[model samples]
Target: MGMEIPDPISIESVGTWSDEVDVVVIGAGMAGVSAALEARASGASVLVLDSGGRLTCTSAMAGGHFYLGGGTEVQQATGWDDSPEAMADYLGLMSPECDPAKISAYAEDGVEHFRWLESLGFEFNRSFYPEKAVVQPGVEGLSFTGNEKCLDVAEVVKPTPRGHKVPVPGDTGGAGLVVGLALDKLDALGVEVRWETGATAMVVDGDQVVGVTWKNYDHTGAIRARSVIVAAGGFVLNRAMLEEHAPDLLAVESNGMALGNTHDDGLGIRMGQSVGGVADYLDKVFVTGPFYPPGEALRGIVVNKLGKRFVNEDSYHSRTSAFVFEQPDREGYLILDSATMVQPSYRFQPLVDGWDTIEEMEQGLGIPAGALAETMAAYDEAAARGEDPEFHKAPEYLVPLDQGPWGAYDLTPGKCFYAGFSCGGLRVTVDGQLLRADGSVVRGVYAAGACASNIAVDGKGYASGIQLGEASYFGRRAGRRATAEVAQR
Candidate 1:
């Protein structure tokens, strides 16, 4: 035997049918699959491994909205005037530490990324829905899913809709059908996809990553490959990783659940970190609040248990969700009225207690005699005057809550349906090369999607489709970069 390997790989002999391919991909989610497809198309023998025993993942569970703009075909079809400069300006405001080069690259080439996804047989509709929504409301493919148009915000970029919802409908939404189509394309391309195979550690050769040691069901062996691509997702599910790196997010009440699928346990990140890869943004988690679907909920106000308005009610869903977690006791309620139509979310069904008047509702909620009443009076007065002096809420959603039949939905951590996903992962360059603490690139290895945190790490700044868009976009870039590696070749 060459050298005694440890737990994940126990081999009696080397090269015992346990060798590998040109590109060995760990985690077969959107990023991994995208990387695999690109590598295979580049004439490299590719192998994809999944911790999940199947093709499904957190990507599959998503609404399938891919945030794309920058004069894309869909934007052209909608006759929406948008450019790369506008995209860059709008997205740069999301996070202070967001990579400047990466944002520029995304704004300039996201249209091509959208087209690449189309080449994978994924399709987006040409129509645009001119409304604010978490996902597309109608069959239209485009909508505003961020703070792009919110009032009192940075007006440097003229607003345009960017959330491109994929054409997958029914119970599963866009993820089910689009991933299925990509699977068909990968199959046609002869990409080897192995399910139930989990990479446990990196097989490093000096400063370069040679391969990885993995466990496939009962079989444990090392796959010696030319290069490795780790798209195995972030550490949201790994309690130890979260506690060690991002304790604040871990300590936050997440309604007792991590937003991602079970396989998102930081295995890929850990494997990369073992070989000098640096992880970042572990404190950033995208939290989705139970707000707006009927559009009427936008007229409502959210308050802490102390009955104080915490954020602009009209902010994007993710932004609203993050602020709710910052409230006292990590809980609150959505205060609304008869004009504010209440629509229930499939995920969040907080107790909706309706009362005849503000005073009666305050009595029912036990919000210290005059606190909630005064808050409502101020909000109603501002709405009637067609302005929100307190929170700068948009005038269109500023309809007064004066009408009786007031309602309050629980926005508590354990009670409401607040969902969060760990957005922190390995730090990478604009080209998807995993970086070290010393800013050195981990040669022969690449990472993308939630496994990397150079993009969209600001939980409060997330736009819908950003994760999916980044996965497919940078995954392909990483894939192309890996295939061009002369050492690997």
Candidate 2:
């Protein structure tokens, strides 16, 4: 069975309203918090609702990478000269269908947004992560969280690292951003925050979304508002929705975990849909099968079932994994020699099989007898010459993998430690206004975060910090526009 969109309750159906506010923001994640704060600052009465009892939304669970560019203070301090045009150009190339207006807006406004986050105590140290990594180690503030440095991307735009992480070590910075920073400010500003309260349906009057109905353990009611913002999240945890929208995820469902918590069930998206909002790119997902962390593993070569190199191993992990997922039967193998092999820094992918020679590895992994040997010989020859004509891997990472005791990591979808979340949701403009198929607006309805198909629409085009960056940035935009409407009235 597929996901069923709920029918919205008409304003006449709710004889009386339990409460009222100028703006009602749903889901207290990064986006929702940003929205509520901005709306309140604009002198609009704001109410925030969370489906869960606590702040464990996907943003809070993230690794705290805010993909800010355009020469943020930290980026300038670290000596990376970046411009809004360069950032927009790189992002535009990331996905052909990504809205250019959103990319331009995000890049142009990123430096100011960085200052805003710093004002909220989201501290960042003035330093750069020096190695290739999925996440920067220790407390450094900037890292390369995307394929900007890859040969293809660097050719189009001057590559610059923009993943601005919180100074907190490890993945706990996300919790710090949500609980330690945004939550306290919300309390100080007296935004009405209701937890354990889930939004059930939108309340419509004619063609406008006037409010939303809600429910908890004991009661059900409606909150009448002039504007409503749904920052709920994506539908990765809902199996039915995944089966209907992005079914490729199910192949690795048992072996991997969803990036989001149980509350990411797509009700917020469905609620928006019921009121004539439309969605696109629903089949996209951000699946990552990381094979490096012994960064030396970049010297290795990844081959498909046909025993040919499919991608540059030095590309971003998600980019590599996205290519792996498209191979025959979603199967791939990483060939590494003894000199390049080490205990992995992360547990995502482990050495599944090893052998003393290339021929043995081919036979062990069920590839045709001579395919692995020929591929290895060609790759080694190119490495020895400090060149990669086929994939254009950087010369620095081009090491000859001729050492003894060759091994392979099972790059098959289920065998690798693949983890991801859905990237598709309701289609919205750069200001976070929901729009229908024919470019008509759903009045009084706005959205941000994972629930809105804003910047992060393509899995293959993903960068680490895009979700949190766009969520908070666009969330503030939604709040401002929603309240501006109230001021007009």
Candidate 3:
């Protein structure tokens, strides 16, 4: 007999409430924080709520790479010419299917957004070249270089590097940095932050959004807000949502040190849908590489179902996504030999020896031993020849894996409880208005960060710090806009 599946729990039974506020921001992630900060700056009373107990969401769990243009101190030093047009061109080329108008807005506003972030006390370091050869050297190199460079190269645009990282080293630590800064600002601005509050649904009166109904973790009563900003984040955690929304990619398995808050389960999206807010980009899901098993503190590699390597092995984000979306069966392996095991590359060093040996690693990571050995051999040959045979990985640097006591970390598709792909979500106009499917703007709604698309200038998944930059940029804009709307009222 088949196992019985329980019905989806309706949030209404858990809580109920009535309250009013100028702006109710959902999700304490980067986007939510930015939105709240922006709204408060605009002279509005704000209520910021999160489903999780903590303030930071997945955004905080990230590598802290912010993709921006024209303000990074590095761009000025490197003599890399860039502009909003160039940024837009890069985004268009990378994700051609992305809405052009929205992309243009992201690029155009990116300048102002970056500058705004600086004003908000968020410091962005100048561009530094990436250590890995296969990975593009600089953030600017990834988007606005070569034939990929913007068409108006001779315009003397004076492009600033956009990749700004929060000085923190790891995911949780990084989130602490961003969230702490934003929270400090929030407190000063008099924004009301309610922890342990989970938004169950949006409260709609007639055709417009009146507020939101949220509950505490204890399954207690609900709270209400007059105006709400659904920045709760993407549904990467809700396995049912993943299976229902993105079936082709089975599940998302990731490192435990995710940058964003894990509780972000697309409650905002659901609330938006419930209120007839048009949701776009449902099919466009972010995909990341497989890593070592959860709770293990080490970086690892990702191999396909056939136990073969794909993508540049060095890139943590790319490797994670490729392992999740591109591999067969949404399953893969992380190959590590004794040499690599002993002195793993800086990227994988933290993940070394976190799990068992190669064969046991294979069993735990879900791959065959023989196939894993063959894949390692291929990598070995490529390293010897000074090139990546399988993926044509750039030959700038090589790390061999000849030593024994080998290990293979298995990864099967699962919910992205920690980190995964960076794609899809809310649809926003270039001017930052949240849009509906018929190209209509949802009044009083705005979006930024991973929740909104068109700003990923390089389309290389989420850059290290770009989301925070977006949050800062649009958060300011949306805040000012919301404040203005309230003032008019």
Per-model TM values vs. the true structure: 0.92, 0.98, 0.69
Q: Which candidate model has the greater lDDT, 2 or 3?
A: 2
lDDT for 239 (candidate 3): 58
User: Candidate 3 versus the native: TM-score?
Assistant: 0.69
Write down the lDDT that model 2 would get.
0.87
lDDT values for all models: 0.78, 0.87, 0.55
Clashing pairs in 1: none
Query: If the candidates were sorted by their lDDT against the true structure, best first, what order would they fall in?
Result: 2, 1, 3
- Most accurate candidate by TM-score: 2
* Best first by TM-score, ranked: 2, 1, 3
* lDDT (tens digit, per residue) of candidate 2 on 1-489: 138887888899899998999999999999999998899999999999998866667777788888999999999999999999999998999977888999999999999999988888767899999788877768888998888888877888888999988877775555445544777898899887899899988999999999999999889999999999999998988889988889877767868878887889998888889988988888998888787776887888999988889998888888888899899888898888998876556666667778898888888888888988898888899899999888989887898889989888787887777888888989999989999989999999999999999888866788888988999999999999999988887
Displacement of residue 428 (Cα, Å) in model 1 is 0.8
Which has the better lDDT: candidate 1, or candidate 2? 2
What digit string (tens of lDDT, one per residue) describes model 1 on residues 312-342?
Answer: 8888887887888788877678887877757
The positional error of residue 324 in candidate 3, measured at the CA in angstroms, is: 6.7
Q: Estimate the overall C-alpha local distance difference test score of candidate 3.
A: 0.55
**What lDDT score is found at residue 77 in candidate 1?**
91
